[model samples]
Target: MEIQNDSPVNPKQVTSAQERGNPADVAQSGDFNNSNSKKKKAPDTEGGTAKGTILSIKLAPATDLWTTLKNGSVKLRMEETCCGGVSPLTVTQMFQKTVDLCGDHVAIGFKQEKQWKTLTFAQYYAECRKAAKSFLKLGLERFHGVGILGFNSPEWLIANVGAIMAGGLAVGIYATNSPEACKYVALHCEANILVVENANQLKKILEVQNQLPHLKAIIQYKFALEVRQPNIYMWKAFMKIGEKIPESKLDEIIDSQVANQCCTLIYTSGTTGVPKAVMLSQDNLTWTANTAGKMVDIKPAAREKVVSFLPMSHIAAQMMDIWIPMKFGAATYFAEPDALKGSLVNTLREVRPTAFLGVPRVWEKIEEKMKETSAGSSALKRKIAIWAKDIGLKAGYNNMYGNTHVPCGFALANSLVFKKVRVLLGLDHCTKYFTGAAPITKDTLEFFLSLRIPIFELYGMSESTGPHTVSQKDFFRMTSCGKTMDGCKTKIDKPDELGSGEICFWGRNIFMGYLNMGEQTREAIDKAGWLHSGDLGKFDEDDFLYITGRIKELIITAGGENIAPVPIEDSVKSKLPIISNAMLIGDKRKFLSMLLTLKCYMDDETGAPLDALAPTSVVFCHKNECPATFVSEVLRKHDPAFYKAIQDGIDAVNSKATSNAQKIQKWVILEKDFSIIGGELGPTMKLRRGVVLKMYKDIIESFYVD
Candidate 1:
């Protein structure tokens, strides 16, 4: 695969080191090209290819790539396209091929009231074909968009597949999103039909039905609820109408799909305002699944049992729940959206899944629960736990992506200490555990590793479909997300002293562009074809990508220091139990401070009351005392390592910030957690910075006063 840099720019017009007044003359200083002149040949290993250890990989300075354009603009080659030998497959064809190859295999499983309902690969394909016929009957063929608004269920996947099968684009709206937000996505995507889960979702659609002029029909999955509207259609009735359609017609519809055709419109959970509809084509999804699979070592039979609980609307869930399993012919178990915790545990035990995907929040909950149960244990047990954790970390690092070379003492520790921890969490059978969506704390990651669960961290955006980089077992780095996946190039543009810069990527896996917003799309993807990820990241000498934060999310203090709040917040949250979400305020202010919301678990009868839980204040807390006190004491007794990490992070944040933006001078932890339903968080659980600032304007103002 080759990156085509065909942008018209004269070489003579390009800036030189002398013109920039740089004395180093870095690019022409030495015989850098001769560094790899003596390439040694190696004997072929498995699959007729040389297998050897990767010594090192590093990023050259930006000064090396920067050039002045004819238009007086500075241009640099951010990333080279890394396309592998895989061809793009349409969403419809992907499912059809899977069904053809594994007809009797279970394709999807979900709860329907009491018993779990399942669909075989062939049955799933047949239903999708019939649903496609129904969509065609509704005049939704060719370039049309279909919206799916519901929680995780068989119908949601059916609607998604059906839309694509009919040569239309699938657009997913978060079930928790407000009516206005839903309307925004529907209108933005120009969706003509919407498949809703039940009456509640239908009501949200109805509330803004008039606002969406293009929405012609609303199909509800459940038949029990009554929706007295001209546009409403029951899912069963809709499918029954297309039952008479011949299978040949479905084949024709499937064949009509092109590789570059739009498959889905995934709207990102924008932290600033309304979300943008990212236009992901068949090529994008196919390449993403293929590349991401290689990075995480997603093998065919090895990755069979996968327990999926994240929202299907999001890219992370979409990759694991829909794409990856289908590509590898793996069986996936869907967890009930309402009872995620119950379903997760039950599914883990019942399926004994080999692979699982989780966000940082879910893993943190598991860590918290584990520590809670083991707190104040015997000294022998404590020592055993420590010994087990050390061993597990070694094993975790070695076997992260696929490498497995456990140390002798660590192997013994794993058998003695970590084995029970894995059993307790139902992770004894899990071969691969992945964490994404948000930055995970190293301490939190290490805690899971100690439990014998290899938690591999990954990084990506909605535009990339799923994780672009994932930590390998042998080459794992807690601080970095991982190396770039096979067939994808990643680089930081205009890096600072810490090597942090706007992360840019180039590959077939990148989305086509934002739907309908041509101007914004052009701005996001430059003339050189690289996608500006808008995230600030850096690559280490080992090629691991360390994500700092969103470039737009940087907090520039009055002292002129630019702070990336994501890393700081992640460090703090990993240490503090009561805190759930935090937003670092004080941009252009004297000192840095934070507005935090308490974890919802603290309010439950099972856990002790939080000290900051004030029910009435603008910045409410559950109680009046410091919520960190109990958490600190608990950690001090059970895990001194974790306790010190938290203390160190707090001290660092205080010392690093200017006087005005220093460690939250007057902090108030909210009683309630920020959520999409509450208008505090986006659908993807990202804090809405503007909304938060407005909500706590007075409290923020108090910091400025005496």
Candidate 2:
């Protein structure tokens, strides 16, 4: 796909936020000359190819992230991109320009000590530079991985920029990973100098430091109770040492940076087993940042505002929170990590950001809250909501002449109903809201559409630099991952009779491949240059790609019919308001079954997390016990009303399935929810199927009578 340098940000008014929500607002400017590129066909419209888009890329450098080759090749060789016109500066140099333009502007905000705290762009830049100087003083080498372990924070941002600015690699570790998992990353990545948040992280690192052969110094951020150690240094003291470094040294490091070098290592969410560090180059990052902004019609220099609530350890968040802002001058606000469940909505309301990104879960929680709220409200409020929602659903599919646009009555509907909902949900200013990192149910997407809030679904993994495909702004297909992103070409390798195949991706967007694991890297990306994403997908006649399921995850039943579990599982979750996770379990079995976990059921009147889930909704027994016995014993203990509700939810899901092989035949509710700390979920909240299956092996086996 191709996009032109059509809508450049007005240099005269650099302060203006690109508030236009529609892509059509930015007219096509530069010529689309690439013969391979497809042209604009509506997202849902069949049989037409979108005219191919040709985008001019720029080279930016912020070298070496995590995981090193440590091989004979001192500098890794990779294919380059067609970067047109101006040669972009290193990431730090471009950031310096951004700092100059967005100086004194409120760049970041977060809650601290029960009050809101703010940081200006100028101040943020200064902190990053100071932190860089301190890293230099500590004798950090260029391209050395400076491991960072923390949630999203002002200090984390500063340290990341600072490390890269000082010509060192910035490596982020998931704050939720186990001590063993943490040790694996630190050692494999070859990090010596590490920065961590608070005492809990420090405690974890200290426990593993003896095992970490390369680790030497540790820098600690905020702590209510300080821990003293020989290698530990307070953040304030670290910055003070920066004053001793020569100012010219910092500038010299920036000048030496090159675009083709590695920038960061974004580890894949290893659902099957151990994660591999995917090494992304500076050009890979810069290209993604530049194209992402263009895809959503966000101006490169415009001061767009966005929420940074997702983990910085994840690639999507890295693009949105770090790279997007640095490339586009977008103001990013950090929501208190602990309070994101309760406080993010309020923060978003206050920020009223133009750009919003969320996983399906985040959107579902908010959507569920609205449903519960509407149920308890007065008659008139309920009627108005029902009426407004009808309008919204229509507006979502409303075609304005040739262009697909929101129904003309949406403004009226919004003023009457959706306006209040948007205000309450804190999305009044959200123009481009994206959902990815996981598949969203059709019901959840429809829920947002029924609310007249455009929540577009995109598809990508850390291997593909976050977004490989994105739904067009106004015209989008809820069931699809949308059109291919600019600079990306997709191929469905050996499709089945049903047209589903393993999604293979090519172009400049693919990563430089896995670090150290040569065999794995070669397996993932062919010498021909196509990165085989294990996802089973298909392109519509209109070229909109639809992700079906993962190739390895397809369940072949006893009847020999293959089934996709995600859709069935997603269906169950959407049908059941309280269910947080639903894993289908019928591999080599008679029929499909599921293991269920609720998201702490809500109180009917108060809309709060219910303390008791009708007392018997959960099955309780020994870990080794059979599921049938567990459920029987649990049922003997209390009223069956709760079980009936769960059964009804299961039935609802089964009704949506097209075939008997696809429908869930039986299920069991687990006593606990799948959690990251529990080793059932990755840091990105993706289910670790192997871990979950092993942990509940007994529960799964009991589904069949033996």
lDDT of 1 by residue, 214-268 (tens): 8788899865657677668888888876776777887887765555546787887
Off by over 4 Å in 1: 1-83, 340-343, 376-383, 394-412, 600-649, 655-666
Best by lDDT: 2
lDDT of 2: 0.70
Residues 1-706, candidate 2, lDDT per residue (tens digit)? 1222332331110101232221111111122212222234222211122444332333232122212362211111221222221232356755766676677677777778868788888888888989999988887776667788888988888888888888767788888866777888888777767899888888888889999877767898777537778778878888887798888988888766655456677766666667788777665677677766667677655578888988898889988888878766788888866533466787888888888998877787677667667666899988878778888888776631134576666788889888887888788888788898888888888778888787788788888878877775744687788877654567777777778888876544577667788788778876445578999988776677889998788889999988888988887876665577899898899988899875554443323344344222333222213133323344455336556667777888777777888888788867766665567866666777888889999988888875
Judge candidate 1 at residue 664 and give its lDDT: 54
lDDT of 2 at 423: 84
Tell me the whole-model lDDT of each prediction, alpha carbons only: 0.66, 0.70
TM-scores of the candidates in the order shown: 0.80, 0.83
